[model samples]
Target: MEDKFIYTDKERKLSYQILDELKDTLDKSFLENDLPMLQVQLKDSVAKNTIHRNVFGLNPILCSLQTAAIAVKDIGLKRDSVIAILLHQSVQDGYITLEDIDNRFGKSVAKIIHGLIRIQTLYQKNPIIESENFRNLLLSFAEDMRVILIMIADRVNLMRQIRDAEDKEAQHKVAEEASYLYAPLAHKLGLYQLKRELEDLSLKYLEHDAYYLIKDKLNATKASRDAYINQFIAPVRERLTAGGLRFHIKGRTKSIHSIWQKMKKQKCGFEGIYDLFAIRIILDAPLEKEKIQCWQAYSIVTDMYQPNPKRLRDWLSVPKSNGYECLHITVLGPEKKWVEVQIRTERMDEIAEHGLAAHWRYKGIKEEGGLDDWLASIRAALEAGDNLEVMDQFKSDLYEKEIYVFTPKGDLLKFPKGATILDFAYHIHSKVGNQCVGGKINAKNVSLRTELHSGDTVEILTSATQKPKAEWLKIVKSSRAKAKIRLALKETQIKDGLYAKELLERRFKNKKIEIEESTMGHLLRKLGFKEVSEFYKQVADEKLDPNYIIEEYQKVYNHDHNLNQPKETESAENFEFENPTNEFLKKNDDVLVIDKNLKGLDFSLAKCCHPIYGDPVFGFVTVNGGIKIHRTDCPNAPEMRKRFGYRIVKARWSGKGSSQYAITLRVIGNDDIGIVSNITNVISKDEKIVMRSINIDSHDGLFSGNLVVLLDDNSKLNMLIKKLRTVKGVKQVTRI
Candidate 1:
């Protein structure tokens, strides 16, 4: 049977327009050969019904044309990326293959299509940009930087076309992903114009009210703003002409999203915002004289107006890692209002507009070393084996604003703003960060948490006794430090877990007991452990005693062997204690209602995860025919659900039970004078709460301790935690 072909008039019109545009813009060879071949293949695919429109009913051919146009005009991608963008869908739909593309176009084109196909497959599995999927997406981007550029261009095209789309939910999702994912990617790639457009478009859909408000306000003030800018620029123009410098000036207003951010950050309305616009002075200078001309213009502008010394930013001396080079300053303008001015040459302006693509073009290379470094850092974070941390590190690294610091030997290093001394140590080497006790900044002794400032000379202090601690994760700001700390902590946990496992096995052998892996697994599950490693980790952490585990294992093993024995002949009490003879709880309706007047069954709150009143909880039927209430988020709850799911039952507090529940709080703070006393004072001030015990440990100018307190419900416990957080020197206070 012949397949039905579908093509809309709009799709045909777009194709013709794009083909005409490509004929004018692209090389003759591409227009005559590649373009015609692609068109034929696309038509065949559509005729076969292999290529279908997206969920929004967007024609695939039209989408490809629009995305390729963006890649060429906006992102400055070459024929390879454009070809990949056009044919990836065909390759994905099985109308074409990677090998076919490789033979027809080139390996570069095929590789980009492969990356695109991988991302598409990932989206099919989980459309949400979550932890592991996000990492995979980033991996695809890192494989070929052009893939990222093309994807960003594609997203921009989609965002623009979907402005009046009927699917508001899908629009919102697309806009959110653009804001959260693509905008930052654009910014990181140095595509400032695209970044602003993405942000503004996202705001238009996501926060429609705020977007229109800012846009309307900007529109209303445009005439006056322009007149004022001219009045401010005329004299500078005349002076620069008199100085014989060639430059053009324009007034650029901030985007609506930028204005909205300013309103929120400054806590004011549009009228209250100063510097709503910036004056960009583009200089026409040769490559050799670009910086000279920029600085000369800077001098002319500062001479004309009273400049704010602190607002001066000199990126010309050391361009941003993304290859953005511009000198920015804030000067007092005609109305005594502060006005921001940016000075750059034509090449710098292009780099500022196009980002990494223009950088590669000017540098005569296909990629940049800085981007490779960023990708390397991302790989390191992925290897750290924490999905959440990888996601956090990925986003943070994407939107990082860097600050340069100095080593003791005059070597300069760059780190993200807010990077701590420990971050610097890690950047120097993993060993230094691990052994870092403190550091000397500008000849002054400082703690590991001290934030580094630009141009500060730093000296790291280390000792043989110093080691990485769990608290260091909170102290450092850079992803490198965080990843390194996580790896170190994981290594320690593994070692401890292995040692604990060995100790348990040796104990079993000493007791003349042969461990059956099946019985042992069942015992761990019954005891609320999902994984053997976790059980060993708990034992390693001293939360579960090895002797107690052995005793439980022996009982479970003996009971499993006796399962075939005559049940009627066995003692009822022993059977009840061993087998818990109650019927399995219904998944949906079974609930253990706890109240003061409860009767008929013995139950107690579990100690493993202190489930106080007002806390969401579940009940695990113990091996002794009694139910033990546990907080749903209790660490042991997973193991119980995984191993002994039959024993799991939903639970809730039916009434305000008059029972004091024991809760432990872990507090970490600076080891300051009377810090412990201050913590105790906060607890003492709480009249309804009683402190049962407090155990403190101090090392290397920091203190971490556990405080066990008795409270009636989660409310008092939360209140107490809040007060403890407010204590002087307290950094983190969390429930354990």
Candidate 2:
């Protein structure tokens, strides 16, 4: 046998004759130059699928290739895209290896095919990943942009052949995914025609009855609607011709899916749906004259038929963010039916039909700049994390409605609806959000939680001390704000942890014991603390006792060598006090000592009581702070006595020493200008007094506030209050 390439018997059955007709069609399209090589690759790829059947029991790869080629060619896409569409299934289905693809077709086709293969492989390995992630994953690899275009074509072809699928469950799953993922992707890419087709086809399977009913209604009303549309457009056409304008006029009916959506959204039946049909006026005018000509057409149309002002959509004045440009008006037509009239130039029409693809078609470029920027933002978010928050943001950016707001400098920023001022601030910069207190909207003061609307000018007010709060997560709608808040809170926790570690070390030094990592880990495990910062926060907040910690440490490590179990019957004497802390008990027999040997420790009167020298009192040995003296009959006395009897010490007040105690007093009265100054002036007269912080709130002619001050004794406090009561506008003052 001579060296020769042999075709498989199955490969010989494929009709090369059909490819000739395909080439004739490709010639009509702009892809005539690249047809010869693309035809060769398509034949080879289709030949490998002889033994394969899709879920629909047909040669899905061949069908998909043909369908995709036709689709891309019709949309005016170039040859490379058509070639990629043909080979999209070859490498992924094992018909050809990636190396073989690169060797035969070159790297561009290999890259696109590989991108699709990667997406399919990821979904296969991680089926738990959601449809939304799959959509995002496809876009993430869209650096080439051809991958996305080919993927879209693949979806459209699949949807076209979906009716042949015999498995209802498979059919339904495909339809649901198409509706939720592929349709939205197409919409965002500006493929309006393909988007509509995908939605209608998906709806046909997912919502059978509604789909059939809408289709039937459209069929039933077709004749009457045509007559009305013809009557509606006749005069407008004559007027435009007379006005020396060149234009093509045609009427269109809403897609079945679109009509169904309107009915469902407006909570109405088919009969109540107005604007179900539209008349499009595509003008042939130079770029400079496009706007003037569109407006003139609008005037002529409204003159012929009455237009509803509220139903007007002037996208031509300010084009949609996706680059859609048109002027649509709903006018009263024959029999009082509302018919929408759309006006646009030829270029706008091409862009409207093709979306991102149109940009490439007109520019003759290899990529779309706008879509590239969008995909880059999406990739940044996905690479940041793979959690629900990031996924939610990806979906929101893809599918949510956007509103544009202005800054104080008149710059426009777009945000999703329901986003608060905090989201806007964070979107501008992280530091701005961290320092934001509250700001003004259009020069009027507003809260940080205020929701933003289109065209409102926002100004963010900031403060150095305004840090992120855990509760802010609930108030913010954007993922960026939520992520920034989480990072800030985490940093604060880390700082608190370091502070707590230092506090624990200082306590260990006072006891002359060595600190070790194992000991700290053991303690954390014992207390069920997950993070070091959480443990430290509890200690700093006084929610955990340092005494219990010290006692537990001694019982675990410093006792006789067994560290497996706690010594349950340890006596109180095991805990000792130093002499400097205990020596004062001998000098003053009247002073009560807590825990026997816990003697002359530094102590202060509790601000809650402010007990006088002669008043009956008891001492509370706080964890790190030495002691606090409380009145024997204080309101908190019962709870203290019941909870920790061992921490309390017996005592009685001695009328012996002069000491000042800090106290907070709440004052309420009528609102007056000099009220705060007069109150402070009265306190200034006492030489023994020290003034602290004061906060005041005045509302509806009534003032209420808190004042922190130090007084020598109860007598002085009482006298100071008597003076405060006599001040101008002062009503009541009580120590809190």
Candidate 3:
């Protein structure tokens, strides 16, 4: 192989090593096609200026091919996968076209290569790829999972050789990609060794000192640690042998990055870490006895070593959501050091190592586990379409930890960690979740947003009045919960829109006006509504007042109808006012003084919210009435400002009034006896103030009430409220 190579000596050696690794797995047809393609790739590497090299100084095309080949062999991929790996980068670097690959390798290989090339272009602009970019890359190649396998292989190979590259910046970029993106991806795909190696190499390059320190510590203690592991496994090995179990046991140490993580999490040094080693027992058993054999292994190991009941994880009884099945236990070993022990059969170990791809490889076999359902859900989510946000959520769901919770009937259900009761209800059924107002976790009533933990018995509480709130979208973490909440909100919005449409039509009918499309369009624009449906939705939800539509319609109707009619004649004599502020006011016996020149004008205080003399007042001209005075901050001001700005006029006091005005005071205080009595005394003591009504409420050591009083001006009202605040037990007092 090396003698036929036209590239560098190192490249020839690496390519041969890759081919050798695959030789046992691949057949003769694949090998014959691979050699010619390899030669063509070498020639094409020079023909096209595919001369650009990665930081490792290897030609991009050759490096990618090697990486892809190594991954295919490790992943147990077949012929088309191997061919796709070889030509995946060929079409992307302008060395050859997709048509050429299709002609040479057939259409199956061409499609996979096409998917990979398309993904390459999506993130080519972003030099530093993160988990999000990886997700998009997955989506781009989701049509063919083989493309993703090749991509992950390409990433693994890059991380493997990144440290040797002279460019530290490129090394850091690749390290970040490995740690943040490819490592988790590998883990999801069930390539545990590849995942661990990617993570370790990333830590080695990203945090050099910490990596070396842990590495050196492990290396220095290797001999002593190996001896302890041997001593600990000796008893379990003997017991398993005596039990007639056909099994192989091996001692395994934790990865360096994993150990560093434990140190950071537990705030401890390396020496303080326990369970640094694990003994795995892989059994050779028929499918019928696999579970029994695994449990038997567990029993034998525990009998030999006193197992810590708290450290037992029985995944065999219920496999992880990712289809991971095993029984793990921590036991007291020799020298009192704790050692973890894993029990599984050969098939379980394969699934544990290879993930869903393993299931695909063994799909024709009857022994395939529960991965079919999980994969179905994953593929459904991926095929849901080109929604980037949903893809982000799907990516998050992939990495979510599985937590097993129980129902009131003791039925077990699995959910992501940090999933709320709302998520749980939705997982049961959409209707149950939609009507769920609260739930009882372990018989304690909790809100719908309460996060559930493992082993808690949950019972949902539903109400006919309960409906999904927009805020629920933020509280629920599961994609199902989020999707359901969004759907419920949208349905509610559409329902309200229909009701709003009816309400608007009824109002128009009552006003003897037709609901014309042209008029409605004009009305929506004038009211600042972008769409008619939005306006109707707001009206149905009671967020927008229907009166706004009627008022604006009337203005438009009058403007058009009066265009041809003669305009009304007016003179300075008709507006007889000596002072502008008193123009609309007529003299009255009440404390509200008015201008005598405006004697015939009909005027009154607006009752929606009373406007005192010192308050900022606005006069609105009514159809039959001369003027109505309202507070500037009145609730009706916004509608008036939008629909009838011309009807608004300024009004002020004549500075000659001595009458009293009623105002409401809201007061809160500590619920002490005689608190209300003290408040009344303060109000009554003011000679200029008159108390009209006092309402007091006290409960649970807290008192709140409203007081209505008459005062000459805002100054007097503010003074009275302030004096009431100084009373004992009073926390806050405000004029309403």
Candidate 4:
């Protein structure tokens, strides 16, 4: 092992040989379409060199794709499918482009590759990476159903490579990502088999101790269960075989995570978890009579093993929202062990495995609101504008439960289950939302944050000058409202600056202060503003009060150090940042650190890893000298905070955020009267101050709501609470 690498003869054969075929297949597929452009990019690489040299060495990267190609071929991938598979990782690695695929393999191949490319394994920086990644996967897949399919194949290949990862920590990281991000995605797409394997494989690394224990338990009971399942299926098998039918019957145990979750939930032992295993019967029914005949097979199976009524899930009738179909029933077997059985035709099995996407056989079949429809909606929305709306809708539609509600206009609006009227309002229009005063659900006045159920018709109330309230954020769920509220808050701050400037001009005229841009410029510079707009925005957002600005202007015009830079001895030195401030991220000077969590002190996870328990961490002194703690591994902490490590403090959660921080909320939707007063009433308790201001901005039939203050942490905030939480004519709350 030269670099201590353990690649063997087996690895060399499996990878190199397989990749050669994959490369040839891709070349063939691309050549079958346009040849010149892709050839040039391909030729850019010298022989014996790599196409994606930056990310991996020529051989190793190629070898990974080759393994994928081999697996694809085994699964009967065609030319476009194999080429797309080969090009998958390279796109994100920046070794190639969609244009390369289009030029070489034709538009169709490029489309397929693009679909697969939609599944993200790449990285980026954001305060909420998992939520953002989830957002991206949701929106991307809505544009191409094939993305889920490709992700499935990618997971398959990654699972196989798990054993080869030498680093214990690295293995766990990869496995945990697979467990949380990939496995759920597989389940959402209805790829049960892939879901099972991925969850099991991930669990092996993530909870290895638990995994081995579960494995041992299953192994201990394997023989007896196998014998009993065989006997249980024997009668049904004989009946089907006697009927000249062809089918495959097999049993599988639930994965470790599933069993663990069940055990924790039900407070049960392995023996108490009787339905941990299932017997699946795959039938050979034809397409036309498939549904009817599948029920017949179900009837036969039920007759063989007495079916439990409560445990029977008739998904075979309605099918899952993802288009998964199969008759699932739990039966009392001869041993009295509960046996779960699934009876489905091969087509149903395919659909069950692939979700709405598996139904498309070729280009000709007319799909019933198929994957293409969803993908088209996503792409169309992206192209149509409103990125926040697109991102929100994508997240709502992609990951979990979805519901559809109607507006007064009779237009059907789809939303995540438990979506608030605020979400609905933002869905309508940002301007209308900004002006949203209130709303009526089913013709009865309901809070803007009220969760709309299926078929509920909402009539939004609005006001032209209505402002977004801070409390609505506590209730709204959809990101649309959050985004709108944020944008509106920004826009309102600018507008308010303009308004303040007008007011100041009048005051200057009354006071006989000369009106000159140069004088204003000097005053602004004295106040430490980069531009007049910033000054105006501060005034508009109430970060600068007109009285303060006027007094400050007088002082600057008259030489005032009373406020600008107070003596170091002043208590204000300990007070940092704007009061009722916009939490804009910045690089600060004067590093200092303190643990708010010490005794009854307050602290926060310094925007990196949101340091939970057991994370290697450190603290950094910020300009405010307010101690900010970060995971020692935080990227920014290493760069900005580490130089002065003395400021960093060790932080652990003392339970959760006390009381919910009175953080202001932003809601944007339709504009009508009373949106402000209504929302205000919700969080209007005496202890809660409006702080700086409430902002209302509107444009093109949309309104945005913004409330600024301070508040508690996330779990305390929610959509339902947002509606009842308060805001007038509020459509949605957007957090900036």
Candidate 5:
């Protein structure tokens, strides 16, 4: 009744008498298999298995141990190795210590247990280890696959117990895990039966309604099903037996989930799903003969039934990389029903059931290759920590889908799901990722972030001067690229910061001021900053204001309270413009350098264009924020000319010579409510000056087009553009 113990008739069989009985099974396997050296360790393997028995109460789990024992022993694994598999969950269940495992079972078993513990830790959290970890873990397995196989076996046993879980939540979690991780893994291992069963049982819990619907529908036609099976199998069996070929044929239907997937994808009912049932043919012939005879059987089946040519798949000729092989065909059976047929050797069938484990078993089962090497890459990522980009790479690169693409050299590159050309570049070499400005996909120039498909022949474009852009993050999909991009951005920020700080320090150095510790302290403390070096840090960080800091020191010496507040001055009768600007407006006798003027230089309206006193102005200083005068009244000047208009200054022709400034004018009027260009007449009639950029926003009855011009004096420039406001359909026009 306790959650920790599975109280069953089998649990009662754990008495000394039954222990001896189980020991007999172990000793029997020991005599049949295991090394002459390992026979001495029989009691140790059995003791570990017995100790592992009390760790889980699930009766089905205990049953799985027995089943796994049969499998491990059948593979001729050594006693110590078998013990490791039996006690695989001992660490997960908190029943035993790693030290105990090392001390009792030996260091080799302890290492496997340790690796299994790492895998369990990876599973405990939702994060699938990142690709680096996954890759490294796989590489570690290059040394030993027993660790990999043992972990695989533990997952298989857990999947086997999923259906028996009484707790609905636990059942769903187990089934969901089985479907998401285990089934794919099983398929990857070439264990067809485990994958199918995992999917089938998972679908029952994941989608109960569809499961029951399919079950009910199938049950309702039991007699008809049996009849169909008989009608379909009789001819194939009779012909095969008569042909002197020994084959076993059976019919199978996909699980409800598979059927439902078809329904969802095709948007059809169950009845519309053709070839739902599969006919399986197991050949007892040799590997090569199995394929030839299977094709011969296929010919016979096609002759008997209307074979669908498009449905035939020959995997035996080129087995999948994960080692699955078969010949599949579809044909029209009795009642005009479409049915599929799968053909393979018995050895293939065993592999289909057991996958990598079974294949390892078939390889003489005494030892296994470890999966640690494969997981080494994953451990590498784990050490990188949960940097947003790094963790994302780990999740996406390591755990998403695996896509294998090829380089120009014919080497296969495995990429994470949605990996782009940029990711591929980074995967090859960090320099490739860094210098990869763009590349070609299938020999056509494409964006760096282009997602690569499986079998894509990617050719990366690289340049030494090319650097990653901040916008690259938008399209680059691989975690590697993302992490690399982030790293690059951080480096760029550091560079920017250093540049800003250096520029600031150099300017102060030119002014004969030493930016010493105490002087910086006085400046920073007065500004309410925490640290003196932080001022330089912010400058180097490219976040501090050079002008403000420089001006702050200037203000301390000069003590001026006049802020440049703009005011328009004009009289309707006289139309004379007044300059309400600062009297300390600078003189441009010298080139515009950092000066006392607010615009950073001395600027004045020229008499040539006669920029009016009220016209807006731009001062581009020769130094940082330098001064080059422009009139806010200029039409081209409205956006930036008026943009920094407050940065404008009112100046007189106190200059000894004539000077000119650029400015703009605007003509405003109504766009005809129906459709007419009222404002166009004014611009066409009087073309005044240079035009820059025009933007139009049109709604009901409003039209505005701007015109730009060169001005000599601010006073006259302001008066001329204001007169256009009186034009008909022209609502108003200002200098800016």
Candidate 6:
């Protein structure tokens, strides 16, 4: 490469200054020998048109220097990360190869640069943070945790510089990515300081007015807030000092983004938000004395001020998964307002501030088992194959607070805050979760949907007959549980589908009918099943009888073969009623209209998904010539459409008929007093409605029942359902 690009005097001076600062943090030998050579190479590459300004129009060399500075100062990263950040662009632009860097700077540095180049390539393909790209990005980060730290530092640098850029749209896009992606990553890594900075800066660009309003309010109240913090901290500081605790305290105000979130969450203004600042008591203590000293300080603060027991968080005993160790409490301070206090040792504070980098410093690189576990979870979530679900799992894993619980054998378990009993069971094992009927929490039985709390001792109760259901998805909170449940459900569906297919084949063989694949596929399509597996699944579930399918298949097979065979002997017992004539239809011809005003045709409402007046209805031709009216959303409508599209006819209700249609509503609620009466009372009160029967089943503190009612139209049925929903102890009411 030729040295064609020239640096100005000022630019050369600034570069040396950055280099000197980096030298202060990095090794002297590397700075004296390798850095100058690398800088010369980067300059030569720039002259060869291998480097360019980023989207924000930042000079690549200066930006890389600044990003490396952030990595060193803010994230506590060392030489390998800085070198990779500096040289990644050269490798990405093909000016320098990975192997060349490997020979010159060692494999560790080259590997990081390779990871960074991979990320850069992904961005070039799609700059937006889409699901597939996001997954790839996470996989790259998982390869080397330092890559993530470097990226976070780089993002912070970009966010800091883009404020003055000319492109408002680009600024907003970058800000949104900061908020959605990088901020959560920072939080997950325990980089609180950088996380707050990223968030506040993101809010400044994303929600301009709201950000400024909170910032301006904090500014306006700074003096009073300072006075209050001082007055509140004075006594606590005096007591702690007298108690022989070597600790320093500082009052830190909440981030603007945090305040805005509180305002939106609490639906209040800035003035209405209390505890706007936290008191951090960072102690200078050795590793062995850290926990006891933190607890002593916590006791001192709580004794001095009336602590709200509910607001206490004792992470010092069992530090966060990200290596955050602190004792937090909210107490009534001077003016009787709540103030949050954090107590942690210096080592803990450093780890909390710098995240995984400082964690690696203390625990060493080989012991980062937690990071591996987190990466495994990310990989597991990606296996779900649903983009939105994977995104939700990623965000939730990043931001949601963890709750600690215990097993029956005294083993401690951690879960996200809203983790349910089913989540715990799934975490224990897939089989345990699948068969988990309920659980015993502290010797008291609770539902699988029950949310676990800190210190709760749980014992999952399983039954041999119990199996996973689709509704279990709503009961569980963790992504692992959801993924497991979906997998189990799918496996069961596949098993049932295979059985159904075998059963259908047996029926065909017994009838001496040679099954044809094309005819069968056409039959399934006419039955509204796009997939043979789904069609068989329906048969296995008994929603579609194998016998009915065989009959349909025979018709299609006969028709496709062009065989003019006489109709099979009709089974008289299949008819619900022998006479097709109905008194209601005879009295009112305009009440129901078939396709193209076809009249005097035999028709009946489908037993499955009973179609009523005012319901969206479609007509399906039965095995006989008669048409059956069914709700468009009928459980079997899809199969009907797929297999028998030509047999489906458009139908509509034309007039208000003097006929009552039977409809079933399912009600579930607490097993409480007069619950049945309360439900019946609502139906009885409705003048035009009649209750045919009520079948109630109560078990384990819950009641579920089916109420069959006769009404003239869907309007009345909807009203009845609404009224039933308002009844005491009624949790949910839905039409069956």
Top-lDDT candidate index: 6
TM-score of each: 0.52, 0.53, 0.52, 0.47, 0.47, 0.52
- Residue 481 C-alpha lDDT in model 1: 85
- Quickly count the clashes in candidate 3: 0
Report the Cα lDDT for candidate 3. Answer: 0.73
Give one digit per residue, the lDDT tens place, for model 3 in 340-387: 999998888887877655555332222223333434454344345321
What's the TM for model 3?
Answer: 0.52
For candidate 2, what is the lDDT? Answer: 0.72
Assess candidate 5 and give its TM-score to the true structure.
0.47
Which has the greatest TM-score?
2
Question: How much lDDT does each candidate structure score?
Answer: 0.79, 0.72, 0.73, 0.61, 0.59, 0.80
Scored by Cα lDDT, where does model 6 land? 0.80
lDDT of 6 by residue, 606-702 (tens): 9989888889998988888999999999999999999999999988877555577788899999999899998888888877999999999999999
Q: Residue 429, candidate 1: how far off, in angstroms?
A: 27
Once model 4 is optimally superposed onto the true structure by TM-score, how far is the C-alpha of residue 294 displaced, in angstroms?
A: 2.7
lDDT tens per residue, model 2, 1-736:
3222334454344434444545565555433435665656556754543235667754553565456564555354444455566666655666667787666655666766766675564444323223444455456534444556666677787888778678989889888777887788888777899899989999999999999999999899999888888888788888999999999998899999999999999999999898888899999999899999999999988988899999899988776656678998988888888788899999999989877656543422122344444644443443454211232334323323455555765455666668888988898898899899887876898989998864466899999989888999998988888999999888887887777778878888998887666676677777899877788888876788877887777665653347565658988876444343445434432344444455556887787776755456789889996788998878899999999888888765442435555778899999998888999999998887788888999999999999988765666778888999999899999877
Q: RMSDs, each prediction?
A: 27.0, 20.0, 21.6, 30.0, 20.1, 23.3
Error of 3 at 202 (Å): 0.3
Better of 4 and 5 by lDDT: 4
Overall local distance difference test of candidate 4: 0.61
- Clash-forming residue pairs, model 3: none
Runs in model 2 lying further than 4 Å from the true structure: 1-18, 21-51, 125-134, 361-736
